[model samples]
Target: MQQLTIVTPQPERPKRRLPKWLKRPLPSTEMAFTSNVIEDLNLETVCESAKCPNRTECWAQKTATFMILGNVCTRPCGFCSVPKGKTGEILIDEPERVAEAAARLGLKYVVITCVTRDDLPDGGAEHFYECVQAVRAKTGADVEVLTSDFRGNRAAISRVVEARPDVFNHNVESVPRLYSRVRRNAIYQRSLDLLKQVKDEAPDMPTKSGLMLGLGETFDEVLDVAADLRAVGCDMLTMGQYLQPSADQLPVERFVPPEEFDELGEQCRKLGFSMVASGPFVRSSYHAGEMAAEATS
Candidate 1:
């Protein structure tokens, strides 16, 4: 006689869901107004291009971080969702358009950032200066410029420093160990040099750098990066959880809990960072105006 045998298949595990704290209500009318203003002036923003999780909330508050020098980026960083490709013609009218958008929105403080434009001679430094000047001329609002490293071109960095934006921010994006995988084509030392150069050129100008966590970096590594920034006279720091923009980008290794962020923020403050913003939803330009004001004050 033969014995009968039976086997049952195992069920697949469900995907990890975003925690409750990350959820938000649907867009409001204020968001619609912010979108309309940006569209009317034909301007671009990092919020829309990067698929930032805080876009809905920031727009609903009638605030946005404008992205200049065209939305197409030259670098293909693994963690970013901004479109990357060959450079396009410089939009000569972009500065004025950004000014108009800021004026229409009644923004008291404007934060302007740009995609990496390595193809250009100065990495768009002169354009950044013009945009800052135009915004100041139009709205009389304090302007903050978050710029690329300009490939560590001293002349290019000096140009923007001379423009005298209220704050000069360049994000390190990740710790040194993860730079190769997280920020391709970016050198960790070069970024540090850029921040140092900004401070050296204009000691009074507040310099800022940011990092995204949850990329397999240990807690000590993040603090070490902060120490490096502090060594170079970085005046402000922003830490945030890295979220995958799409399937093609790097997947989230972990969803860092809010309490951990709070601990990191406290640690950074003890390291002497004048202003620190750390949390799941924090972005380089998130609450940028408030950070600038508080840091400078």
Candidate 2:
């Protein structure tokens, strides 16, 4: 006797939907004012460039992280949407413009960040120093600079540290296992080294770093990163869910629940981080002024 068996194949599961926690109202009137001010000054903001979900909220609050060294980034990090390759000529007057924009906005705490200019000799560290200086001189406000790894050049890191910004930030971005896929051009240890160097050079000046979740990292891995950050003397930490900037970017593996962010924040505090911002929409510079005040308070 012969028996024939036919097995039915299982159907594919559908992709996860955009969680309710991730949705928010569109920009308000205040956002228009901020947009006009930035546009009038011919400035670039990471809010718009990176398609940050919190843009409306941040802009309405009249705060935005100024993106210097032009809108184009040299690195092609899979999680970022900032334009990459052939960024054209550098804007020498950018520092002054940033200061002016901050002054116009009447900001008390100004945060400045830049594209990764690997093509440049100093990795744009000098320019970052100049921008921080200009912001301080013009507005007399507390300044924070979120910079690149400077290709692991101690001299370059020293250049920015010499400016003595109120806060020095360089995001580690992801865990070691995901570094290759999420941040192909950056090394995890090198980033940790950058934060450690900042602490060693200027112990009083707060050092900060950020990470994006939902990029296929495990819960234990996130805790490991928090421990590593603490080991390096990082004063502040920001953890947010990774939102895909575009169709071409890496897909989100899971939408970390808001409750999870609360738990992570507690864990970060346990690790001795003076300040921690963790949520679905928290970015490196989101509510940065408040974070700075909280950390120093």
Candidate 3:
């Protein structure tokens, strides 16, 4: 096999001029509802914090992913916009609030994720588990939890697996070559290993993962990563065009045309992923529960 490489056209540092399209749409009524629910419960969410471009569409569709625990992260990565610092302290009431927020939103699909809380003994794994359980009891949404690796703690991971969320997501943000450059604080193989453990523990659950493109990642590397996920029995994957969250963040290497994303998604399906959600706007939790449902069926 010929070696494949992603030849990225090195773009200049960062463009200050925002494209008219990138200008955010006015906050819709749904954003208000979602915000109120979050604020009412005193919860934090990636949808609101990271400035995810999908917020208006996802919220308008009545789906919002929740960020559990506090918003402050223990580790900072270049590709992310989540606030990072010394995690002040765990909010004892957070899990219940998340459950309440799910109830208030009437969400049929809920995505729960948290900061990398290495400060705690269980790495906050139990908190994730409880949040899922709470949401299930309150709103009964099909659950998906995108979690940290718990520093590769199998026992801590098992605590989450036992809850049996409908979908388990662990995003390897980029390939190993770019891991250090893009997500320097994150360990590439550990993310792969974490997904493996999720599948190993909950084989019946639809296991899913995602990757961001245009971080100078080669298309072949994307395909190879897809193959790697399939080899381990991951059932679903999401591929999306990477957007530089801010000027300080990594710049986009290539536009990654829509046709190419379509081809990649089809090839990943051929590689044995039960389902693939691929597009410019797709994110880690993009239509997550629907894809997981498809995978199970």
Candidate 4:
């Protein structure tokens, strides 16, 4: 097998200007009905916390991916915008509130994700289990969980798996060589192990993972990561451009062209991912419901 070469990014790489393809129109109905529901229920969403480019479009469509375990994250990754430091106390009623918001949104496929809560003993795994259970009990909708690595705690990972979300997602984020800079506290192998555990615990459950491009990763590196995921029985994959959330975060290494995304998608398909979502605006939770449906189909 040929070794995939790692591209060493320069210490002071010039910021890549945003291209026209990345431009999105302002939200016409900024505070749509879904926004009101989430505000009323006092629920947090990754779409807002991560400052996802598709938030306006998803919100207008009255669909959202819920973010539990508080707004602040314990781990400070360079590529993420979620706030760092002490996240304060965990909200006990958060699970119920999340269920309420899902009910209000009338979502048939509910997606739940959380910040890395290294402050907690179980890494907030029990809270994730509770949220999945609450959503299922309330709406009887199919649930999908995009979770942290649980700090490689198999017991914590098992706790969430016991809840049995319809789809299990753990994003690899970037290539292994870029893990140190892009994902500070996260281990690339640990993420792969997390996804494998899902398949191990419940073979029938569809497992999913995501990758973000334009972080100075070579195409061979991206394909190698995809191959790694498929080897572990990962059923679905999402590949998208990594947009730097703020000036304080990691700057964008480059803006991947749309045509390149299509080429990547074709490569992923050949690698045996049951469903692949690849493009500039494709986030892990963007069109999550459709992704699950497609994966199962």
Clash count of each predicted structure: 0, 0, 1, 0
Model 4 poorest 10 in a row by lDDT: 9-18
Pick out the ten consecutive residues of candidate 2 with the lowest summed lDDT: 10-19
lDDT tens digits, residues 1-297, model 2?
A: 899899999865455689999887776466877898899999999999999988888888788999988889989899999998797678889989999999998999999998899988999888988998899999999998999998999999999999999999889998999988999889999999999998998999899999999999988899999999999999999999998888768889999999999998998899999999999988999888889999999
Residue 265 CA displacement from its true place in model 3, Å: 0.8
- Candidate 1 structure quality by residue, lDDT tens digits, 1-297: 999888788864344578887777776556888999999998899999999988888998899999999989999899999999987888999999999999999999999999999999999999999999999999999988999999989999999998899999999999999888899999999999999999998999999999998889999999999999999999999999888888768878888999999999999999998999999888889999888888878
lDDT of 4 by residue, 1-297 (tens): 999999997686566788999997877775579888988998888888899988888998889999999899988798899989878788999999999898888899999999999888999999999999999999999999999998999999999999999999999999999988999988998999988988999999899999899989998999999999999999999999999888888988888999999999999999888999999999898999998888777
Which prediction has the highest lDDT against the true structure?
A: 1
For each candidate in turn, the TM-score is 0.93, 0.93, 0.90, 0.93
Model 4 lDDT, full chain set: 0.91
Taking every candidate in turn, the Cα RMSD to the unseen true structure, in Å, is 5.7, 5.5, 7.7, 7.4
Q: What's the CA RMSD of model 4 in angstroms?
A: 7.4
Residue 214 of model 2, lDDT score: 98
Which residue ranges in model 4 land beyond 4 Å of their true spot? 1-15, 27-30
Q: Which residue segments of model 3 deviate by more than 4 Å?
A: 1-12, 16-30
Name the lDDT value of residue 127 in candidate 2.
Answer: 91
The C-alpha lDDT values of all candidates are 0.91, 0.91, 0.83, 0.91
Off by over 4 Å in 2: 1-15
